[model samples]
Every structure is written in structure tokens, then in C-alpha cells.
Target: MESFTESLNRLKEVHENEVRGLQNKLLELDSERCRDAQRVEELCTKNHQLREQQKALKENVRVLENRLRAGLCDRCMVTQELARKKQQEFENSLLQSLQHVFILTNELNRLQGENEKLKEEVKRLQGPRLKPQCREGASDPPSPLLLPSPGARKAIKEKTLEGQEEAQDDHPEKSTGHRTSPVAKISPSANLPETRAPDVSPQRISNQLHGTIAVVRPGSQACSPDQGPPNGTP
Candidate 1:
């Protein structure tokens, strides 16, 4: 009977210990549930803040798109205006250039016609003076005889002065060889020395006389005093 009573006490102590363990386990589960609920509340707040930020970002994108469209339209209009202005300026410049070209062409044509007229006039003027060879538009160098020598002008002046002095000594009352002075006076050529012309043959002279004339100076023809007839004679 004492052994049975001791076994029953031992079983009663085990049941109390088991009951305390179950109460401690219940307290731990309640603490874990509270921590999970607090965590869920914090996550819900974070999700609401993220949704507000997404809406703000969407509104900002809409504003930026509207500004970009307005800017593009303004740029296109400016480009069109610039293109029109440039085209107008180019047309004005081209028109002015064409006018200048027309004016220059007219001037050039007038000058060419004038030049041709002048050349024809020169030919017409030269027709009468041209030689047979020259009539064909051929030309010869000028003859050395046509151009005076360097000393020729000086010699001609000296001779002219001497002739004038001799011509002034016309004495009507003077007598020569007991005969009275004739009405005809001694020519100025009497003061000059006797000179024969160049020995060119008559054939050569006739040949060279073509298309040219021979010239003799006035007051140069004179008769020698010895060859003069007596005064009052025929």
C-alpha cells in the first residue's frame, strides 16, 4: 500500500510540470503573432508611399512631352521661314546678275560694230592713194627718200635765208656790160652753185614715177646772166 501511494504522487508532479510547459509555449506563440502583425503594418505604409511616387512621375512625364511637342513646332516654323527668306534673296541676286550680263552683252555688241565701221572707213580713205600692189591689201616699207635726212632740214633753212637776201637786191638802174637792166630780175636761184640731178636713167625715173609725182620748189628756175639776151632785144 505505501508503494502505490508514492507512485500516484510521482504521476501528479509530472502532470503539473507538463501543464507549466504548455502555458510557456502559448506565451511564446502570442509574442510571435504580435511581431508579424507589426511587420505587415510597416510594409503596407511603404507600399502606399511607392504608389504616390509613381503617380507623380507619370504626371512629370506628361508635362515634359507637352513641352517637347511645342518646341518642335516652333523649330519647324522657324526653319520654313529661313528657307523662304534664303530663296528670295537668291532669286533677287540672280535677277540682278542676269541684268548685268544683258547690259554687258549689248555694250560688247555695239563696240564690235563700231570697230568694224572704223576699219571699213579706213579702207575707203586709203583706196585712192593705194598702189597696184597695195590695193591687194599688201604693203611695202616706206622709202628712205620719203623721210628727210637728219641734216636736210638744216641745209634747207640755210639755203632759204641766202635766197631771200639775194632776192631783195633788185636794182632797176644797174647796168651790166653797158646794157640797161632788164625788167626781169635775177632769180634767187642765181646765188646757188650749179648742180646736176642724180644720174638715174630716164627708164628708171619713169618706172619709179608710178603712183607718185615729182615736186619742184617755186622761184628756183633761173637763167645764167651770160646766157641773157641784151636789153631791148627780142
Candidate 2:
């Protein structure tokens, strides 16, 4: 009977300990549910603030798009057309300048070629081989013969006349047979040297002598001793 009573007491103590363990488990579950509910509330507040920010951003985007459609599109089109025209004008001017430069280059090349040709021609003309040919083609003119001047011719004629006067003086018979006039008796002098007068021809001397003889007529007065015969008498 003592053993039976001791076993019953032991069972009763185990039941009490099990009951305390279940109560502690229920308190832990309740604390976990309360923490979950507080976390849900904080999440809901953050979601509401994010929705408000999204709506404000959408409104701002819509206003900006409307302004772009109203005036900005036309302004951009006009600016694009002006830029295209300026670019086309620049291209045309560049093309014209290129053509002008090409023309000038061609002219310069032609001038340089002509200059080279002229230089070669000048060198050919100045060569030594051409000198003898030029001299042969253009021969030197014959030299003129030297002749006596007018003063020398007159002195020769006077010397011839004096010689003729001396010849007349040597032949007195011929002088007496003649008119004995000073002009008719003229003859060359013996004291003068005998020399040939190349300038005075024989025909010219004979004509002068005949002219002097015919000029003195029988009744005409003789000329003065100082005066000489006129040249036109011949």
C-alpha cells in the first residue's frame, strides 16, 4: 500500500509540470503575433507615401510634354531649315573656289612651259656654231678708195698753171708768134718739181688753155695783172 501511494504522487507532479510548459508556449505565440501586426502597419504607411510621390511625378511629366508639343516642335523645324540653307550655301561657295583655283593652275602651267621653251631658244641662238654662219651670210662691205679733198685739188691745179707759164717763158719764139699777152705766155716754171697731177685730167687742162686764148679779143683791154681769169670762160 505505501508503494501504491508513492506512485500516485509522482504522477500528480508530472501533470503540473506539463501544464506550466503549455502556458509558457501560449505566451510565446501571442508575443510573436503582436510583433507581426506592428510591422504590417509601418509597411502600409510607407506604401501610401510612395503612391503620392508617383502621382506628382506623372503630373509634371504631362505638363512638360504639352509645352513641347505646342511651340518647341515648330521652333526646332525652323532652326533646322535655316541650318540646312547655310550649309548648302557654304558647299556651293567652296565648289566655285575650287574651280577658280583649277583654272589658275592650268594658266600657270602653260606660262611655265612657254618660259622654258623661250629659254631654250635663246640658248640655241647664242651658241658658237651660229657665229660663223652669220658672218658668212652677211659679208662686210668693200672699203671705199681714198680721194683728195677740194683744197688739195685746187693747189694741184695752181701748180699745173705755174708750170705751164714757165714753159711759155722758155719758148720766147712761141710767145712772140702768139699775142704775147700775159695769159697766152703762161708756162710751167722750171724751178717746180716734175710730178704727176692725178686729180687734173689732160682734157680739162687743154679746155682751160683754149678758153683763156679765146676770151681776149683784138680790141678788148687786157685784164689787170692782179686779176685772174673767170672759171665760166670755159
Please state the error at residue 188 of candidate 2 in Å.
68
Q: Each candidate: what lDDT?
A: 0.53, 0.58
Candidate 2 wrong stretches, greater than 4 Å = 71-234
Error of 2 at 149 (Å): 57
Local accuracy of candidate 1 as per-residue lDDT tens digits, 58-166:
9988877886877755567799899999999999999999999999999999999999999999999877777665645435433333422334334444444543454
Q: In candidate 2, what are the lDDT values of residues 1-234, reduced to their tens digit?
A: 899989988888888889889888888878887887778787788788888888988997887788687766657879989999999999999999999999999999999999999999898877876789668645754233233344434544664676466555653322223122222233322112222222223343454433333333333233332233556343
**Which candidate ranks first by lDDT, i.e. highest?**
2
**Candidate 2, residue 149: lDDT:** 41
Q: What pairs collide in candidate 1?
A: none
Q: What is candidate 1's local distance difference test score?
A: 0.53
TM-score of every candidate: 0.28, 0.27
Q: How big is the positional error of residue 154 in model 1, measured in Å on the Cα after superposition?
A: 43
